[model samples]
Target chain A: MSNFINQILQSEKTLAFPIMTHPGIEALGKTVREAVSDGEIHYQAIKYISEHFDTIACTSIMDLTVEAEAFGAIINLPEHEVPSVTGRLVNDLKSVGSLEVPTLDKGRIPQYLLANKLAAENIRSKPVFSGCIGPFSLAGRLYDMSEILMDIYIEPDVVNQLLEKCTEFLVNYCRALKATGTTGVIIAEPAAGLLSDDDCMMYSTVFVKQIVDAVQDDNFTVILHNCGNTGHCTNAMIASGARALHFGNAINMEDVLKQCPENVVVIGNLNPVGVFKQGTESSVRKATQKLMTETAGYKNFVISSGCDLPPFVPEENIRVFLETVKSNNV
Target chain B: MSSELLTKLSECVEFGKINLASPYPPQMKGLPGADEITKEALESGVTPGEILNDALISAMNKVGQKFSENKIFVPQMLLSAKAMGASMIHLKPFFANGSVQRKGVFILGTVFGDLHDIGKNLFGMMVEGAGWEVIDLGIDVKIEKFVEAVKQNPTAVVGISALLTTTMVNMKPVIEAIKAISPDTKVIVGGAPLSSDFAAQIGADGYGKNPQEGIVWLDKLTA
Candidate 1:
């Protein structure tokens, strides 16, 4: 249970899990439209990625809209791009009473679950982790983000009820993910990063703590991700009781490492959008080398992208990101 | 009392004291907030232009500076922007009647194939709070939309935002289209995937690291 996560965290070799799949899909000569729509192709993309990198774990696409869509939010899926929630599902609190926790079979949940199960069967080299939207972020999608923020001030009980519903769905979703034999789950909460520390603690972390307790253990752990959190909420995120904390490119990584508990694994945070997908091979190597040197002192720090890699990261840059991590041996 | 009220309005915008009714920040409950102070200033014989220039514009400039210095985060910025928005409801009529002149027009949007607009909205609000008319073309905006917009507002500065590296590259063509249509219009770029270097690489006249920096650059470009 603890084998892969422990080995990667404690070992002298730094690992690379760029939260990527577009590159792998492209490697298969398939478009993202095909991969995202088909579970088998998505798994094959993960398998292709496993053969190419020193990864702590292979992750499914961090599609933040899947759970929202399942919750009855309308989602817009472009032919070859990341899907986004189009409109609010629970627009009013009174309407929130009519909301029901969606069955796992609803929406694209089955496809993602099958993709995880297949990735677990095929990727023998490292642990496989499933990704899901975090509770507050899900609620943000269900009720538009800007409205939710104001609603918190104007309508506290309503926001609380919506978060309660989001957590219930996420808990069941993560358990189903655990049944897939993946090592753990990475719960992404980028939208929560938009909240203040206090607001995040109240609205995001408390719910995240519920999901973490429900899903994490020696065998399976929960990695809490918040790419939108620049700085103010790191304390609340650590307090949320997730076994691992994944940050994005916005904050200074070394500062995050300093505040984090040494026992917990701290994974991060290359700018996947800026450096990896956009940079050349030499540029990736230079950025990786610089970050490696900067955070070398931290024991639990695992080298990773700031957020999910875009659907078109260059192959050479991905290779250099992996190789640079391997050569550092920090 | 007039200067004091205007200064308080600026402070309210800075600390996100939205209204007398807003319970945030704890210490300022029942105290007049930006909404109250702006209304009070307007009724105290201060011209609508003075309120816009002396308080709202000055306050947003401070807010942008604080944002750049990491003195505040997005939530606070959002609150202040909301507060400014509440105050603007009072001053909007003056602008319509031509008593309050806008500094310039900024046409902004998220590039085509991108749906994310948090950054774009933030910049739009900040630029608007700085006394500019923000012509926001919503998400997934194409190059033709930009060129047509450029055709309408020939002298306007254009702002492009893209959260994904894939979509950020789309800015190059949009910039080209706008330039080809109106050679003098300057395009500024910013987002999660973008840096000053990328902005320059894409041939944008300017790169705003954040919403504040973007507003500051727009000020310089218009100047």
Candidate 2:
């Protein structure tokens, strides 16, 4: 086990590791566009959120579009909303064969790496886990999600070839992130959750396992995150060999914990959008307390937002969530 | 022989076998897929309506049920949709003329500010397979677009989708705008972050947890 996971296991208090960075934009009075495009701004957002909130780790923004943008996919960066891939870069086997694996200097890769470096150097109180899109998710972005799903059956070889390229790029990217003095990365593979368990193992986890083997170590951990999963692909997620598995609120947290081993740390799954962004402060407290009470028996369970807390989530709701979890002793 | 061929066509769609050349389900490889069997069934004196009701809709019903039960996922669903699509190509002319009629019109779109459309597309496809005429407004659909669609097809049912918590809030005003224009239009809301309570709070007539659930509600309306 990595030192990060060991520390988490040794800690008596159930920790909070919400995938958040948008709240800091409010603190810095910066637009979402500026924070996502500039490394210094992104690092400042992480730092501000870390200093203000009592979380187990300082996690970078979970931007799924950065890697796709690096691969030349068009992106739409809304002023207050998270960026998204607007157009696909690869459409056919010919395009897939000619697609280039972008260098570390491409697109927003440098900005994210700098943010992790700064956060690792400055945030001594907690580990800094950088975020990146998983291989299948990246390939889906480049090839188009619906197209890839159909191609996975109709053109299996083409999909596998594209996945191989995606995995190659991710391994290199993970290595670069590790060199930034960060503890590990949360590879967001929500796209994999859309597949059946067997297909997920064949198309997503096999490649993700390659990345885990390449970069994961005692000093570096990998937390596999899949917000789109609805309890169908939990075993496939476990097969990725990530030290920790983070799930979205689409499934019951207790059901997932039952399927997981006690040694591998399991974190998740308060609804970030429903409870944190839209629900009342009172609702947030109830939801958090409910989750904590349900998972109290599992030593490896850690409380967290199911996915990233989107922009403009109420501060009072986040406060209520953290306060409830802190007050509830396992 | 005709019934057996229809059974083959239905199996092709249920298993996502697109055509003979498609290599999807390993067991079904080298056999006739939805395309070949659908065409063959037509030439063998199978009426387009019989093919429509007995094969395509029947297969999609099972697909939707499996999806709701979590027995299948998106890839399988997409394959089944593609197979159904392949069969639909042969039946379009019959519907274009006076030989057959669709159930009703379903206007669909992802709410504005939310570009995610996978869920919307799946719902649209399932509704289409279930014999409804779907007018897709695509992603990032504006309020006016939906209101205008409702105005044009006043008697049509409307389905709005959103994948983000931020965008799900937008469903309320869109629903309100549609209701104001066409007070009798049955509006349905769906997506990942939605709940039955949220749907009711937002004044949506119904909420579909999955595409299958939405199809069930739509079928009930026509029934």
CAPRI-style grade of the A/B interface in model 1: acceptable
Candidate 2 lDDT over B8-89, as tens digits, reads 9899999999999998899998998999999999999999998889999999999999988888888899999989999999
Taking chain A of model 1 alone, its TM-score versus the true chain A equals: 0.97
Best by TM-score: 2
Question: Which residue pairs clash in candidate 2?
Answer: none
True-structure RMSD, every candidate: 2.1, 1.4
Collision count for each candidate, in order = 2, 0
TM-score of chain B of 2: 0.97
Task: Name the top DockQ candidate.
Answer: 2
Alpha-carbon deviation at A83 in model 1, angstroms = 0.7
lDDT of prediction 1:
0.85
TM-score for each predicted model, relative to the true structure? 0.94, 0.97
